[model samples]
Target chain A: MLQSIVHVCLAGLSQGMFIWLVASGLTLIFGVLGVLNFAHGSFYMLGAYFCFMVLRALGENFWWGLLLGPVCVAAVGYLVERFFLRRVYGLELPYQLLLTFAFVLLFDDLVKIFWGAASIGTPPAPGLADSIMILGRRFPSYNLFVIAVGPLLALGLWGLLEKTWAGRIIRASSSDREMASALGVKVPTLFTAVFVFGTWLGALGGGLAVPYLGLLTPGMGEQIIIEAFVVAVIGGLGSLKGAFLGALVIGLLSAFGTRFLPTFDMFLTFILMAGVLLWRPQGFFGEAR
Target chain B: MSKKGMNRRQFVKAGLMTAAAAALGPAVLKPTSLWAAESKVKGPIKLGYQTVLSGTLAGYGEFHKMGAIMAMEEINTAGGIAGNKLEIEFRDSTLKAPDAIQNARYFVDSWGADFLAGIDSSGQALALAPVMAELDRVLMVTHAATEKLTEEQVFKNGVKQIFRIVTPTYQDGNAAAFVAKDLPVKTWATINPKYEYGFTCWNMFKETLSALKKDVTFTAESWAPFGTTDFRSHINTIMDAKPEGLYSVEWAGELITMVKQGIQAGLFNQVKHVMFPVGAAMDVLEGLGAEMPDNIWISGRYYFLYPNDKSNNDWVERFHKRWQHYPAYVSEGAYSTMYAFKKAVEAAGSKETKAVVGALEGMTLDSPAGKRVFRKEDHQAMYDVPWGLTVSNPKYPFKIMGKQVMVPAKDCFARPPFEGPGTKPPFKA
Candidate 1:
């Protein structure tokens, strides 16, 4: 019984990391730009498809995809912001949403046109596919990797944001955007850079997720985007720290709900989000700004 | 004169020209006019098919439409029923029930379709059910497998014209039950989408298990909303429960996602037996590839590997050659339903709605999955439901079933009282 609890926790932590990867970017982009990129999950989906295509073209070496896929996705994100998003800069939220939603449809069908309607899934890395001993039972090694990497990435991002000039500028802008702009921060260029950076994080999440989740399909973007919204809202929109904390709470709640109330398991994530909203309208770690 | 008089004047001018052609010869004139008359079969027999061409279940809709088209072509080539050529028209409702009902009305009343059929979801069927009666049209239901369509919620007025060829949802649930009971598992956890069909299957399976074994317990269960992409949490929960058995009623892409995530999370390793009600689909197995582990029992409405008869094999080959994709269960059901419709039309000796319905009610037809006969009681087809375990074979690129069982319709179905009050059930009995 005790063994099963540990297993569940490990699996939940692994999943929480993946959620954090995508949701943190969501939080960062929203926090800085005051624009919710509805196509963020579309970017994530693109990352998976890009990785899959690159792997097949360049041979099935997971390492190459892990390094290069996000870079390529980041480049695309940069182009997407420079060309298309720039047009919608001063527009209403609905206009931004509509444009991003259109992109979602476009990218989804594009995946279908390229990969067909069937799912594209790859096996886990051979060595990490098997389970390692945990709590006297075996749990997947890949899950352990995910659990370990999530906090490391969070800490790394925190360090970069706090310690570096670029990080200080971003932090300053998060507090006082007008002041940061007046201080020669090149706010427009910074917004574009931040957009690319956040999209890269999302893409990296998608690329790394292929081996763990297995299949990436057309409508997956739509599903992920909704969940990302839920996570971002629950964690306090525009707060990276909030997203990180929210992902953990939602992930654990989902896992625990599944364990205890398997039938209502799917609703747990949303239920937790609802509970958090009722408690804190500004989100746990988010400020009014 | 009315607007109709202008069109009549134009026709008379053309006729005057044909009269001039009579000067050439009586033979040439008669032959030309007869050829013209024969060449055009008056407007063709319009059949309406409603499907989900652009949603989560689009794959199912696409394949079913392909099968329906194939059948329509074959019927048209064979000089369609009672010397009337077949014309099919399709509308996409995006798989939503209200949209489907609206489309159903449009096809029958506005589009002037003489016959109606085709739907991908049971919810759509329910929405269209009452309207079918109000419209008083014959709808040959093809792909959707909800038992309620033919049972509690059947079209009240158009019951006679509404004929279902596909087996009910419970047929699938019953097959899962039989397979699960045969296995060595004691405790089970079910993961199904939260909807009628999903609930029905889960309930039927639990009921069957309870009836079969007194001590079986369900340790955990999960009902994810339809179109849910993530299964990580559900996987963790199932692992925590550590049940010996797992049954998932999820189909198509959702099932594919669940299998991949479940395998990665090591949930399958924790359980001794897993029963995926619709996971035996070829597309899903091929997509999963190495992720599709061994000893997982799965069930589908049809298995292309079954029947192995020369004719069925030839059909399979021809279908593959044409589509380059393996036939899914829904596709097979569509094909077989068309064949059943053909057989029923022949038996009735007329395309009159009631006659066709009568002929189909208590008739049997051969299909790729052996012979299926519609039970006179509920209009549900009595055929062998295919169930088996996923066995990876080098002979095929995808996972194929081994230890396959053919649970007859008798085992997988129950007698129908259908609706509480019915003037005449869709079934003849």
Candidate 2:
């Protein structure tokens, strides 16, 4: 029983890490731009597809994909923000929402056109395909890598935000856009930069998750986007820390729920989200408006 | 006397009537000659094909499309169907029930489709069944495998227009159970998608397998929503249960993910027999490629390389030559559906919907999967379900099943009409 519990916790942690990776980017984009990028998940899908293509073209060197895939997606994100999203920045929330949603459809169809709507899988990286015995329970090495990377990323992001000048400007712009512009912060450029970075994070998550997921489909983004949204809403729409907490909560609930209440497992996360909303309508970390 | 009152107009009409009767005298005497002339110049037979054509399951839909198209081309090449060419109007259902129903309506109302076929999801088929009855059109279901679509929902509701070409969930489960009894595994666990198809499949497997292997026991069970990408938590739970075998109802992308994750988590190493009733599909094998582990048991509605009979092998060879890939079960199903429609139309001696339905009730035809017969009582086709063990074949790029076991149609099913106890009790809403 103890061993099983440990295994479940480890599984939850790995899942939570992936969820955090996706939700953090979503929350960040919403926080800075005040536009919920519905196409954020499409970027993640593009990352996976790009990574798979790169890996195949480069003789299955998974490392090359890990590095270059996100760069490609980030470049696309830059173009999108510069051309399309920029026009909607000054418009009402619904216009921005509609534009992003349109991107989602556009990207989905583009993937179908290129990838042929078939699901394809990428093998795990060399040396990470196997499992290791931890505390007498077999756990996948790739999962452990994911779990380790998540906290390190969180720490790095924390350091950048708290200790860097660029991070300070970003924070200032997010909190007081008009004041930041008045103080000569170049708020527009900062918003674009934040959007690019957030998109890069989303794509990076996708690339990281591909080996574990082992399959890519055109509709993959649509499946995960809802979960990311749930996490963002439960954690407070714009709070990175809250995104992490919310992801972990949902992930653990998923793990334990499948074991105890197999029939109602899907509803467990929604139930938790509802409970949190009832207690704290603004979310645990959202600023009171 | 009339001529005294009539002018030149009456005289002209009389002369024209005499000329018309002289010209049409032979055709009026023998109406069969006129009908024969019209038959030679008959209009094309139009079929409306709808399925999930643009989503994750699009691969399945694509195969169905290819099969239907190939059948149409082949039929046209062979002087068309009774000298009338077959044409198909394709639509993407988007894997939604409402969209499927709407598309069915659009096909009949707007396109004047002679018949309707193609539904990849069971829920979509069931939703469209009543719509078919409402439209008074015959719907040949090619891929959806829910037993309730035939036995309970369509049966109890008296929807005779819905005919299933592919085997249902119970048939597949019962077939897999035959293979399971011969295996040495004593304990098993199940992981399936949470839906009508999944539940029915698992229940059928359990009921059949338990009956055969009385000593065997089920240790754990897990259900995930359809289209779920992640299965790590479920894998861990099943692993903890430590069952000797695992039966999974996951298919397509979901199955690929689970198998890959299971390998990574060493779940396969622990479980002795990992069986997937629908995992032997070409899409699954091709998606996983070399990543698919050898010796795992998988089954499908059809196997491209099976039956080893000359005719079936020739058909498969032609399919590969035309499509440049192996045909999945749905491909065969859709292909056979077109031929079945042609045969039924010929038997009915007319293109009327009711006549075709009557002709199709007890229709039998030879297919790539061998002979198939549509049960007159329930409108479900009876054909062999193939299951086999995965092996790495040098001739194929992906893992192909070896030690093939083709469960006979009679063995996989109960007596016809399927009016037995309900497979699943209706929801008390």
Q: Point to the candidate with the largest TM-score.
A: 2
Error of 2 at B428 (Å): 35
Estimate the lDDT of model 2.
0.84
**Relative to the true interface, what fraction of contacts does candidate 2 keep?**
0.74
Candidate 1: stretches off by over 4 Å:
A172-183, A263-268, B1-42, B76-93, B109-112, B155-161, B213-219, B228-244, B261-270, B339-359, B418-429
lDDT tens digits by residue: candidate 1, B1-429:
355798688557645643554354455435544443234333356778877766445566667777777777778788775566777788886778868876776786568776787887888877777777656567877767787777655432335656676667766676677677777888999778888888888887887777767788887777777776667666766776779899888888778878877765567777878888777776687677766888888777777888778977887887888788777776787777666666765565554455566777878788877788876655667777678888878877888888887776765666556434332111123
User: What lDDT would candidate 1 get against the real structure?
Assistant: 0.74
Which RMSD does model 2 reach against the true structure? 10.3
TM-score on alpha carbons, each prediction = 0.85, 0.92
Off by over 4 Å in 2: B1-41, B420-429
Worst 10 residues of 1 chain B by lDDT: B419-428
Residue-wise C-alpha lDDT for candidate 2, range B125-184, written one tens digit per residue: 878876687676799998888887887655577788989988878555788787888999
Chain A TM-scores for all candidates read 0.95, 0.98
